[model samples]
Target: MTAALNIYDPSAKPTAGPRSLAGLTRPQMLEAMKSAGVEDRKAKMRAEQVWRWVHHHGVTDFEAMTNIAKDQRGSLAKAFTLARPEIVERLVSVDGTRKYLIRLAPGVECETVYIPDVGKSGALCVSSQVGCTLNCTFCHTGTQKLVRNLTAQEIAAQVIIARDDLEEWPTSAENRKITNIVFMGMGEPLYNLDAVSDSIDIMSDGDGMAIGRRRMTVSTSGVVPKIQELGTRTRAMLAISLHATNDDLRDVLVPLNKKYPIAELMDAIRAYPGLNNSNRVTFEYVMLKGVNDSPAEARALVQLLKGVPSKINLIPFNPWPGSPYECSDWETIETFAEIVNRAGYASPIRTPRGRDIFAACGQLKSESERLRASARKG
Candidate 1:
């Protein structure tokens, strides 16, 4: 008979504070177990059980892991935490969208949005970094400086927190309110691709969160180098934040275009893995009045995506405080869509959800920086 494992060291003080295992990958969890003094032989098995409890059940307490031996559970508890980050604010829009302002560290914060009726069910848009490096001129998050790339754990925690609030626990395929996820919240996901890749592994694990890879879409403002690598690693759908049809206009709107111009971006889109009629890349074009919304520009867009498997998502520019751009008139948007639609591509006008509460697309700036600015003014 095998001896019961007791890996606890009452006299051993931790080198660092206990970190929550809520969103760590299985390999990460196993490493955490070993650090907790779990025998290497026992760490793997223990990690799988705890991973299920943390992800599938969304449990916040080791005591709730009923299958584990009581003393062993106490040992795990001493080694790690299951607590969630502090939610600074939870704002809900009249249109049934929910926005969460999560404080990751003392000064590091990010915003996540839950929008209903997106895709087969609904979608949660999560950030991969504290702020953005791409100063996409029309976006609120661009106004904030890049603090740091979020770790894999931090990125996954956004989904974990959203799931907790929606009361959508136990990881059932049925009754899932958030059927899809978009990396369109605050950060440029490709800039933090390693963490994003690890997070997808955790979120898609069959015994845990179980969100399918196809249902996760990562939007980028033309980070050309990482495009193919993102597809190969995560296998998530790709969405391009291509606001303007021409090079000069795109350079003004998305400044990153200066770095990775439209031609390079288009080439990358063409070579994205698994791109077919069924698995299409989405081009997100924000329609700005009198800027990139002309019918001629629409024709140019058709030419841009000429031979690619793609659908264009026409986002009516969501306005923020002192934003320079105005949304294109409805008729203008329709005419532009008509031109693209005529070219045998689907051009869906994205509904501006959570606009009333400033939770809509291109409007996700966390309160941390805003508060700091106010303090400077004070």
Candidate 2:
């Protein structure tokens, strides 16, 4: 009889197999296939076939590509993997919001969320990094230590997994349940620019998933250097997580503000490509009670955003365990909104969604990974 090896052996070595193919751009896919011994002409053909199966059909299995020859399909499957990181945990809100904890590699995990609403559009909130570097005071994802960046395939798989749950397959230019995607789940997207850019390119390609560039928004906590590149390259709507109005308070609320102050951040916003009345930039202002949601602050916000064609999303603070902040009073938030509205900015108080499952605007955590890590240590 063969001896059983210890499953929990810490020193057990792992072998590298196929890397993820989730985030490849069309040109990258062609290059990858060509390098893997596929002929140039056949590489293009195979890339299109694989793209259709992966994006349009949402198939993760190589065998599902019916058009590809059986032998080629087997060989491709052996050569390259098309699987998402294992989903570690899943949470569903009372309002049907779904958040998934996905494991990218050993000891690395990230969170992704799916928000559902009737008659209107739904959104998939994806993470760019396993943990966040910004450490925004209002966000739970910021509480964890910064892990390595997720690959483009890992980023793209968040959408694929959402589509898998929603069953919105055979992607088209119009009419889909996942109407929008927001890179506001875990990490600062600007820190993981190359992968995020590559993944979104595949998502926005007309021949593939074809999600509208306008419907997609990449939220940044004022990463000044890469802001223009994001606008010029992606053309996706821009959303800045501007929690505080002044530099001093913002330096605390968003730690990155210490490096690039509000002045520089706003300047970058102004320099963003295609900023106009029709394509107004979105400024996300989280309302914290007594901290930054005062009527004076709201009016200052109006003055602060002067000459910039923009709207504001007033997000009431969503509290979590051991958080330092509290949500602003309903009347306080309303009064604040009124001040901005009177100043010609469309400041809408965002309706709280997915709070029951801790999937609200600022309430996302990856506890499953923590538990798994603990188990391994124990």
Candidate 3:
């Protein structure tokens, strides 16, 4: 008879510290259970129970997993941890938008924003990385250098934290404040694909967060190679940060366009899997004054997106300190929208949300640097 190995031996010094089980997918969680000395036959069942508790019930404490055996729960506590990123600061805008400065680890922070009344339901903007690699000229986050990619657990924790704040527990549809999630925060998501994909899977799990795949959109700044891969892996709604209509201007606006120009980006968009009229791709156009918001540019945009099912999201430029561009005048924006609207595409001017809190589009920068600066002053 083989004796079971004690995974949580009190006197034994652990080789590695406890692993966080928060953001793990079902398969990954099963593997973790097997690693923790759970029998192969029971690992899947055990992982399902734990997954329901951690994600569905939003229980952080192993002791609260009532269905799990006490001995196993104790073992899980020793072998794993369920934690969300620490909320260093949470600011609520007058418009009911909430921005969280979440500290992933010491000195590593990211911003998550909750915007109310998107499609009559609230939406949470989640970050995939601590900072961004793309130096999109107008973006505040681009000014900050890349720190590191957030793990799947860190990404999923943003949703968990927001749900906790909203008091939308038990995962009921009626009380759901955050029905949609947009990966449009600090970092470029395609750069951190695996973690983002896994995190989305966790968020969209029917038994847990229960957010539909269609309600979750992953916005990319045209990472060409990863576009099709993202479609295959996540199958979530796609949004492009398409600020410019032409390559020359786009090369300056979004530097990634230098490598993957408008033509290549359009090609990738055309090839995206599961794209149809109902699941149209979104082209986010920030209306920069005297930049990319002309009637000719709008006509050019319609021409470029020809035969592609898409919607144009005209965002008024949200200014940050030292930003060179200004938002287009309301009349100019309306005219630009008219061209796209006349072309049979929906072109809605996105109202700036969380602007007071600096949580609007292109305004997410970590507070860690500011906090460090203050510490140095003292």
Give the number of the best model, judged by TM-score.
1
Off by over 4 Å in 3: 1-17, 371-378
TM-score of each: 0.95, 0.90, 0.92
lDDT of 2: 0.82
Compared with the true structure, what per-residue lDDT tens digits does model 3 show for residues 1-378?
221111212122224667777767777788889989999999999999998888888887999999989999999999898877689999999999999999877778999999999965899999988777889999999988877877777788899899889888768648579999999998889887878888888999987788888899999999888888889999899999999988899999999898898898899999999999999999999999999988999999999999999999999999987899999999999999998999999999999998999999999898886556569989
Better structure of 1 and 3 per TM-score: 1
Q: Candidate 1 regions off by >4 Å?
A: 1-16
Q: What is the lDDT of residue 356 in candidate 1?
A: 91
**129: Cα error in model 3, Å:** 1.0
Candidate 2 per-residue C-alpha lDDT over 119-190 given as tens digits, one digit per residue, 9 for 90 to 100: 247888998887776688888888787777766767888888778777788786356888888988887888
TM-score of 1: 0.95
**Which candidate leads in lDDT?**
1
Candidate 3 global TM-score:
0.92
* Best of the two (2, 3) by TM-score: 3
As a whole number from 0 to 100, the lDDT of residue 278 in candidate 3 is 91
Clashing pairs in 2: 23-153
**All candidates' lDDT scores?**
0.88, 0.82, 0.87
| Model 1 lDDT, full chain set | 0.88
Clashes by residue pair, model 3: none
